[model samples]
Target: MLRMNINNLIKIFFLLVILSIEIGQSLIPLDRYSTSSILIDKKLFFFGGETVHNLKPSTTLDQILYLDVSKPFNTVNPPFEELPNTIPFGSSYAIAFPSSQKNVIYLFGGITVNVNTDLDDFKSILHSYNLETNQWTIPTTSGIAPGRRREISGVINNNTGKFYAFGGLSDQFTGTPNNTIALNDMNIFDINTLAWSKGSTINAPLPRADYTATLLSNGIIVFIGGRETNAFRDVDINQLALYDTKVDKWSLMTARGVTMENRFLHSAVLTPDERIIIFGGRKVPNDDPVLNQLAVLNTKMTPYEWSIPQVPAIDNMPLTTSAHSATLVGNYMFINFGQITPITNPQIQLPFFYILDIRNFTWIIQFEPEKSTIDTTSVNKSPSNSTSNSPDLPVEKSDNGKQIGIILGTVGLSIGIGIVVGFLGYKYYKKQKYKHAIPTAGSPTI
Candidate 1:
């Protein structure tokens, strides 16, 4: 009787375990989509740029926006709160990094409205906003200021508490109707020390501006193809490369896997799996064509490789435009902004967030965002990751926290239930055999 009770308990436990796993997977939205440079804290950050409306001959912008990146679709409020007007004029060349000791957001450089002129000109100063204080502090740099540049690629080196900026035009902005390629420089800024330094190319380096740079987990900074200055076209060079900060050397191993085409103002998301998820850059073919395609570059390989990532549909693809931004949550990617202009004037609207859930290999187009801003939509919630995907088999990260929890719970419950079920079965079989062997009442005991 005791054994039978144990067996029943075990069966119940197993069923419970399976149920738990299923529940976790079912409830959690495990995927994210993006068309922006991705950064994080407890929250996600992105600054919007001038779309068609503001892309006048010499337009400067004033909008800085961000999103939570972790909202569920059914959520009615949609949780995107526009932050208080912190910066006066909108600018795109802004880079955000956490301060040395405090949790304050240090937003430095790019372009902004000059208090006196209101012209969208190069901003040399830095602004530090305390998320806790809701105040802004402009800190001065001791060394030479990084010359003004736009669409420069930058990433905060977590190891050194410094920001390394690469590939941007010089402070020289020619007011030409078109054709400006003079601004090209790579530099590094020490966030802690507040110093500026320039980078010299080791080998044949691409002096390309408006390029994409993502910091890999291994501390290596991988750079992908970008646009050359006011040339209005992506560079002829489409190869990828990585700069090892420790060694201060560049590597040629960035040209492997699927070769990416030349694109500018494209967005790359470092998936939890360590693969760079890239999307929506205007492609400059021999014959220029606007692209609305998606791709992924695997930076884990020694020769960093790239290939087009698969999204669900062709009908509802992201509209072809640059100056847009994207963020990732779980396996899904959230893309927004980069105003659509038949001509460069500017009509602003929140493009409904497009989410790519990776678990079921599905893409969900959610249109019912309830907020004017996107502070709550584009979040990256991937777990600990490693690059083990071979050329053939691609490894995916935990679809989302909820999915992972469900899987673990299911496994636990299965074992728990299995123990009880096995025990009961054994006990019942033992009782049957014992009865068969009993001889005292006319059967011989074996």
Candidate 2:
């Protein structure tokens, strides 16, 4: 009987250990900034960013991390898998895009930090990683590559197999603020021929960095929200810069509707119906994360209007974040690791990843395949009908919060029960052993 009780206690202890591991896995382990991410097939790959939180000349990460979007995942616990092979060099603020060919991801132009030293080196070469074989290679290329720069904005044209890179900071802290050069030139990379060529820079926007370059269905790349000249100044937020890939020309237009302040280091996703959803970034002058974290730009509308979609307040809704990666998978946009506060601010908090369902503008904590569908009625209408304030949308409750709560409760209960059982079993065993022990020769019998 005693042996059986001991075995049962051991079993309970092991169960407790396993449960603790499961709980640990639910917490996010990644802390990164300025990372570039791309969605290829069903997997989303993240590469090259600073990992450490408060270090100057921040630590650059070389490991490639990926999450399978096809599988069910949640903000509480993202199933991010790391590839065994690392990139050729550690980098941050690089541009990553998929090649027209299968299983190929291209990385271009990021700065590398030597953790042991103060030297920060700028990378100018193009590197390719093969997903199938898990290999990284620097392919030989022809034509002049863009001058070494980081915080560059780039988008790949699937139709022509070309990548358009524009506007990046050439140097950082080389001397005074004026020494840091912001570039306005456009560089084109051909995936098929492994060559680089200069794109037309006539009427290009002024030198900028940390901006977003989104490719439209019509082959026009839209440039938005970045710092100009140096990191201190912001480009005019009113001017909508458009680059026509077909004509190799650049033009500026204006957006109407709700006015938006200057922002940089934000993430933008082009929805299926041609709407650009802009999320979290630092604003100008003070470099604080924008309080209004979500905005929508309807590209299909004439003269392009920006609207603030009213997001229902939820317990697990993401906090303000910048330098994050937002990947549009299906109708849901998955936002990954980013700092909640500005790097300069001492109170830095990194929020867990979150998802936004674009169909009806719902914030989802978990990925539910059944719920992922296009609500045609919601997509056709303007996101915000009123200009006075953000348009209020209907609040739809999600079961994900309850599900997470139940899971945590169950785990907690199991752990508590295991502890009690183990403790009781231990005490009972001690009492039994004492009762059964042979009395010492000198001891008096009761």
Candidate 3:
């Protein structure tokens, strides 16, 4: 009977372990990378991008995906809702920026792959989407649109209702790095006039591609690291270029805090507090993207400064990557899919995403597929090290405290129960030995 009790307890303990795993997995969402995203109201809308199965490329998705992130969400419970109307063609590396009109966003210039040759075709037309009507439309512009390209970045001035487009690549639609020329031209589109006019390129940054351009509160555009040429040595490292719209002037900014090296294809988003947060990009095409640190540029200060925040080595943190998109929605920054590892297969799929609580500097993986080997999210409140000049920022608040507590609690309880069961089993074994050794019916001992 005692042995049977021990077996039963062991089974119960196993059952508990399984339950804990299931509960933890249910909270992780599936991953999708290389998509364009925009936040309207509290909903995040994802447009055409690539999805992968193993290392093989799946079909490029054209359907619009929407997720209501106003509350804590289980990514797979209902999955992301897809709109019935699909974009004319599936695309990737497109620009999706919000317009002055609420619930409206402009989608411009992306590349569609030629399925047969696996080459990319740059798009020249401009498209717009309305969140309320669930509609997509091709808008008319007076002047000619910019040349066909992808991996281009843009920003909109909400106060002025004008849109600005900066540097991007021109040709090489074959997906080959050779024969590509980066542009340094700037274009302006007046939303009210619906006319496109070329801005002065007299003092613009060097011709570059795969760089991040962020519009600050003071109307200055901050252009961070990117490659001026395909050659790794030609890539701009630890450099910053600032463009002032008011004066139509471009000048190099000498940032004094964290010293970051050259990175391209990284994503940057303006925080609510007038700070620009830059995350994951590649040092060079051949090298893996930086995976461990995030650079914060405070635009509110004169002679802008940067602070490098260290990400804790936790299971749930998303892989540091380049070519990803980071969208700011309230206090949360939603990081969408991009290349996670060094491009083993240029067609590789990275389906995971992460969320940074900017207020507290905590990181969490918003979604990871079941087939994924990524770990659960973890938060480190303190910076690994700080420079004497870095600002004393508020500690970011962590929302996963309860979840972390529960996971730790469950594991602890299971361990404790296992130890108690083992002790009882040991005692039972000793009692049985004593009984067996005792003489019964005057039997002689051997």
The best candidate in terms of lDDT: 2
**What are the Cα lDDT values of the candidates?**
0.55, 0.75, 0.66
Cα displacement (Å) at residue 407, model 1: 55
For residues 321-379, write the lDDT of model 3, one tens digit per residue.
66667887666677766666565534334345677878777785453222222223332
Q: Output candidate 1 Cα RMSD.
A: 22.3
lDDT of 1: 0.55
Question: How do all models score by TM-score?
Answer: 0.63, 0.74, 0.68
Candidate 1 positional error at 213, Å: 0.4
Model 1, backbone clash pairs (residues 3+ apart or across chains), number? 48
Please write out the lDDT profile of model 2 over residues 63-84, one tens digit for every residue: 6778767667667667666676
Cα error of candidate 1 at position 98, Å: 2.4
Task: Name the runs in model 2 displaced over 4 angstroms.
Answer: 1-27, 53-58, 114-123, 172-178, 344-348, 370-446
By TM-score rank, best first, the candidates go 2, 3, 1
**Which regions of candidate 3 fall more than 4 Å away from where they truly are?**
1-31, 52-59, 74-79, 100-102, 113-123, 172-178, 230-234, 345-350, 365-446
Please write out the lDDT profile of model 1 over residues 319-345, one tens digit for every residue.
Answer: 554545666665666666543322132
